[model samples]
Structure formats: structure tokens, C-alpha cells
Target: MKPPTDTDTLTAPADATTVENPAVGIDQTAGNFSYKVDYAFDAGTGLSEDTVRYISSVKKEAPWILEFRLAALKKFFSMPLPTHWATKDLEAIDFQKIRYYLSQGQKPKRTWDEVPDDIKKTFERLGIPEQERKFLAGVEAQFDSEAAYSNIKDIVAKQGVIFVNSTEGLREHPEIFKKFFGKVIPTGDNKFSALNSAVFSGGSFIYVPKGVKVAQPLQAYFRINAENFGQFERTLIICDEGAEVTYMEGCTAPKFSTSTLHSAVVELVALKGAKIQYITVQNWANNVFNLVTKRGIAHEDAEIKWIDCNIGSRLTMKYPGVVLKGERARGEVISIALANDGQHQDTGAKMIHAANHTTSNIVAKSISVGQGRSTYRGVVHIPKHLKGCKNNTECDALLINTNSRTDTYPAITVRGDKNSTQHEASVSKVSEDMIFYMQQRGLTEGQAMSLAVNGFINDLARQFPMEYSVELKRLIDLEMEGSVG
Candidate 1:
């Protein structure tokens, strides 16, 4: 692919302004305060050993970490860009111009009072603090390139649950961090994973010890306020024997004229009898390219579940997967993707049953409107030796306009006769009759469209945390406004 053009090199100013709490008019509310990045750090284009070292140096990382980055950088250089089911527009990525490592302040703040007011208001508007207090066992909020706030409720912390920003975890809990950091997702696994290994920053690290169960979900909110900066968050979660935990991540980027890049790596390890659920709701701006890598490993009798929703982005290519490594393990993935004008949402899941009696289920849905395109590409493999394994996959696509497009590519390989596997796919469009019927009930075109779309995604939405589910509905409703006649 050719390098990004000169026009793509221009970085727009950060759009971190605090909008008037929409409920209150600007006249009645305090003036908007936003953080704008004045100085730009140019992390030259392309993957190189020198670039990796620079990123590590910026973080003041130890020697071993630097070595790991360099190795991953080499892998990134050697790996070929995926030829199938990849965004052709990725040629627009100006690697040289992306600032791989960025920190607005010196260190992550533990107290809200110590955080920059603009950043605080930004999260406050998103109800981060409120959600943390109400439903989360812990919360980590990352603004731009680094986590600005990290907090875990006292009771949960006292339960031997370890929830902290990845950086802090690395510095303070080196033993645990070293054991699992890249074990689930090795640096050389893929191009984006390698890229994340080279320049990752500001993600959550969670460890649920043996026999513990976290009643409340752990939440992490990632916001990109800077223009042309890449956010490479590396998240790791480990649930020891008989433990259970649920993790939710929400991400949004401010509007930008030029595209920003977000390449993240997430790894999960569910040991014997452990259960984990990972949820992600991403609402990136139209001028962003989101390429991410996420996977989990489940041991004997363990379970892993993924709930993903993608609403906005110029181009998004992500597949959250799970590998059942021990007997009787289970995996599940439920996803919904919506693409609107000039957007492409390419996402799905992967399941590899490597042991006896393993089971997996995947349900994927996509909606395309205007000139948007949505595709579901997935894989399910149960090797010949894996006896009594079972898998089920269902993909559904809805196109809202004639110009919109949706496609599904599911690859399933079941080699043993002892295994039972099933796959189903369907494509549909928003019916004019349905719209007219809703209109006859006094609903506007936009409202009808939004309602129909919500109905299609209602099942997946219910899987989200209550607050997230409500917020997601509001966001969808907002995005649907004025979208239809």
C-alpha cells in the first residue's frame, strides 16, 4: 500500500471541549472548557526498530520491555497486510505522522480534584464518575493517550481483585504482569497486534483471584481528544480458578477532519472453572480507522463471552475471538454493527475448539444505511482430535438503502464425526411497508427507522451493563435523528 498523502499529514486541533450538558442550555450552564493539544509530536511513518525504542523511551520503560517492542516492530514489518476482508482505504494510514506515545500530564491521577478540569468534565459528561460509583467494582478512564483516572472500590480491592491501569500494574505487580502480558496474545501474532505491542499505552489490567466473584462489572472508558494521534491500548485480564468477572470498555473519539488511528490489543485468560465476559461499545468519529486485535483463552470447564457493538468509524476491522484450550470449555460472542454514509464496519468472531466436549456460539448482526457497507467475517474450527465438540453460528444483515451493502463470510471447519456444528446466515432490508405502518402510528421516519434498528439489536443491547445499554440506546437515537426522510 502507498503511504498516506501530504494532506493526511495535517493534524487537526484536539476537540476536547466540554459541551453544555445538553439538558441545560449554554446560557444556563457554566462555560465549556476543553483541552486542546497545542504541541504535536510527529512519530514518523512506518514500522522501525528506532520507532519502537522511541515509544518505550517516552514511557521510560525498562530494557526488557524495549526489547519486546523492538521484536514486535520487526514482526510488524515482516507480516503482510491481510489480503482478504481488509479495508482497501487503509492506504490512507500515514504511519509516520501518528504519535505513538502521548501523555498530557506527568502521571495518572488517582483523585478527581487532581485531574485537568477539561478532561474531568469530558468524562463527567459521559457519566463516568457516576457510573463508577453506582455499578462498577472499578473504573479506569483514559483521555487521549494515557489514563487520567484509575479507581477501584474499597470492598472489591479488599477481595483480592486487582484492577489497575496497565502501566501501574507493570510497575507495581511485575510478577503478575510478566506472567500474562503477552502470553495470550504474543507480539508477533498479527500486524495490528505487533503494532500495539510496539506502542501500546493506557489500558486496564485485571486479575480476579481464585474463588472470587465480582458482583459489579469493571468499566474502562477510552476517549480520543487529540487529532491524528493513535490510541493503542493493551488490556489484559486473568481470572484464576473458579473466579468470575465481567469487564466493559467504552470508546469514543471527537470529530476530526483528518483520520485518526486506533489499534488496540486485548487478551484474556480464563483458567480452570473461571468465567469472564468482555464487552466493548465503540463510537468512533467518521474520520478514524479502527483496527484492533482481541482474543481469549479458556481452560478446562472455563467460559468466555464477548459482547461487541460498533456504531461509527470511517473503517473498522476487528474480530474478537476465543480459543478453548481445555476439555469442556465454552465460548460465546454476540455482536451488532451499524454503518452509515462513508463508513465500513467489518467485524466478527473466531472460535477454536482444541479440546474435547468444547462448545461455542456466535450471533452477529449488521445494519448498513446510505452508502455504508457492513461485513461479517468469522471462523470456527474444531480439529479432528477434538471429540464431542459443538459450535453454532448465526449472521444477520439489514440494509437500509439501495446503495448500502452487507456481506457475510463464515468459515467453519469441523473435522471429526463426533462433533456437531451448525451455521446460518440471513440478509434483509428495512421494509417500506414496516416504515409506512409505523408512520401511520404517528411516528416520524427517523423514529421509525431507529426503532426498527433498535429492535434488531435489542437482544445484544440487553447483554450490556444497564447504564451502558441505556447510553447506547440514547446514542443510537441521537445518530438516527435526521438520518431518514
Candidate 2:
């Protein structure tokens, strides 16, 4: 198929007019709090190159990180537009027009109450604190550019599990931070990753000690309330030998006419006999660009899993990958995506087997409504030297309307005759008969459609922790209501 040639063009919205009142908190839905292109960097304005330098210099980083940033900046400047299976509509992103970072204070609050009232209100509206107060083992809340509040249970901390913001992890625990910061995914992996490396900020750093098992999951909440802005958060997780940890991230942004960017890089390392599970649920505004890179490395006898869901974004490009570097290592990815009216969601996963007796699995489901489009692009490889390796891949798509579209592209290479590989794909539409049956059962058309959509995603939801599973179901129900009618 010929590539799409029409580059997207985004016009700036009218200049923002906001009224500042010390008595009233910043309104998340109001334009007064939105981001605008400003030449000067001051207390009110967001982060700049100077701010990046300040962060690095304050950490007293080794010369290597600085050198890496300089090289990454060069790559970010020279890299051309991505033409591979992407919806060219995202080409209009104006790098110079965005504020790379925004924050209300200097450092992340050590205590929950230390967080500013305005930012706390934003989380309150989203029911974040309630989630933590109910069941989460720990919670980290990031507003705009930086984490405003971060806390871990005393029992978990006493068990030698390190949970904190990446910036603080680097400043206080340089010995461990330097060892695995970029080992899983290098700085020069891709253009957006390189950009994240050059100016990354405000993401989680987690380490689970040997022989320890965390009973409850840790969570992070990210919010973007500004327009013409980008959030570049960096996250890293290390599960030591025989340890286990589950991490979840949830995000939302307000609506805007102009485009915003969310480009982040995440890496995970699972050592021998360890297990790590990473979950991401993203609901961006209708006019934002979501491009992210996430990958993990599993050593001998280790396991790693990724559960991802993408519901809203003008354009999205994400592919989570895993590299099995040791005998009997395991990896799995289960994802669900929904695209609505003028949106495009392109997502998949990669699995590479470098040792004997390794296994991998991939299950992906996509829903397209209105004029939206969805695609599944993936790769699986087993080298000739490997033996007794196995892989299974499944891709499914559900189209809600005649105008919606879905595509699947899977590349599998198995050089060893002893290996086993399986691939299956299916595309189904919401059947009229099924809708009729539900309608006859005393349900409205919209309610029936929403129930069907939820059923399609129910498999993936089970992989999430109980609390997160409930939240994800609710979010999907809300999205379904808007499209069903």
C-alpha cells in the first residue's frame, strides 16, 4: 500500500486569557492554566534547556550522562519524519512551540499534605487519593511536568524496596541508578526516546529486593492540563533475583484545539527468578500526539509481562518489546485499543529469543468507530542457535461502523526447525442480531453496544490489579457512551 502523504497542519488556538486569584485554585478546564509559547523562562513559565542543565548539574551527574544528552539532542535534531506505518497526520507537531516541562514547585513532596492545594484538587477530582487510601501499596502523583507527591508504605520501604521519583533516585542512590538507567533501552534507540533522554523528567524509579514479594501494586497518576506542551517522563524498574513487583500508570489530559505531545521512555530489568508486570492505561485529549517507547530485558528464569490500553489520542505510536536473554525466560503482552472519529492508534509488541527453552505470547484487540483507524504491527524472532523455544501471537479487531477500518501486520521469523510458532487473526463487527437480542432484553441500543465493547476488552482487564481493573472498566464504559449514540 502506498504511504499517506498528507501532513497534518495544526493552527494555534486564540491566545489564552486567564485570571489569577490567590484565593481560587487553578482551573484545569480553563484556558488561563493552559500552556502558551513564551520566550522567557521564569518562575511561571515551564522548563527550558537551562532547567535541564540545572537538574543535571544539581545531581552532579557523571560526565557520561551529559555526553549522552548532547548526542541525543543531535539525533533529535537530525532525525527525519517517521514514514513506517504511521498516520502522517502527526507531522504537524511543532517542537519549538511546546513547553517541555511545567511544575508548581522545585522537588517532589515527601509527604502527601505538602503538595499544593491546586494540584491536590486536580488529583482529588480524578479520585487519586481515594484510590491510594483504599488499596494501593504506594502512589505517585505527577501534575504537568513533575511529581508533586510520592509516598511508599513503611513496611515496603523496610523490606529494602526503593520507590521514589527518578530524579531523587539519581541524586540519592547514584550507585544503583547509574548501573541500569540506560542498560535496557539505550538513549539512541529512536528519535522520541532520544528527545526524552535529552530532557527527561518526573517518572518512577522502583527496585524490588531479592526474595521479596510485594502484595499490593504501586501506582502513578499523570495529568496534562496545558496546550502546546509536551510531557517527557522517564521510568525505570529493576527486579532483583527472586523478587516480584507490579507497577501501573494511568493518565488523562484536558481537551484542546491545538496539539500536545506525550513522548516517554520506560525500561524494565528482570533478573534470574524474578517477575515484573507493567500496566499502562492512557486516555489523552482528542488533539494530542502520543508516542512512547517501552521495552524490557528478562534474564535466565525470569518473567516479564505488559498490559496496555489506549483509548483516546489524535495519533498514537507505541510498541512494547521484550528480549529473552536467558534459558527458560518468559514474556507476554496483552493490549486493547480504541480509536474514534479522526483518530489513529497504531500499536503492537516485539519478542526476541536469544536462548534455549524460552516462551512468549502476544494478544491484542482493537476497536475502531466513526472514521477512526487502528492497526496492529508486531515482530517475533527466534534465532537458529535456539532450540525448544515457543511463541504464540493473536490479533483481533472490532469495527463499530462501516466507515471504520482496521489492519494487521505480523512478522515472524523462526530459523530453528525445533521451534514452534503459531499466529491467529480475526476481524468482527458488532452484529445487528446481537444488538437486537439485547434490545429485546430491556436494554437501550447504546447500553447494549457499551456492554459488547466491554466484553471485548474484559480479557485484558483481568490482567490488571483489582483496583485498576475497576477503574479501567469505568473508563471504557464512559468512552463507549460517547460513541454508541
* Winning candidate number (TM-score): 1
What candidate 2 gets wrong by more than 4 Å, as runs, is 1-63
Clash pairs detected, candidate 1: 44-96, 45-95, 45-96
* TM-score of predicted structure 2: 0.89
- Across 459-483, the per-residue lDDT of candidate 2 in tens digits comes to 8777777766776676666666777
Residue-wise lDDT of candidate 1 within 325-395, one digit each (tens)?
99999999999898888899999999999999999999999999889999999999999976999999999
* Cα lDDT, all candidates: 0.82, 0.79
Runs with alpha carbons beyond 4 Å of true place in candidate 1? 1-34, 38-48
- How far out, in Å, is residue 348 in model 2? 0.5
Pairs clashing within candidate 2: none
Model 1's alpha-carbon lDDT is 0.82
For each candidate, what TM-score against the reference?
Answer: 0.92, 0.89
Error of 2 at 350 (Å): 0.6
The worst-scoring run of ten residues by lDDT in candidate 2 lies at: 1-10
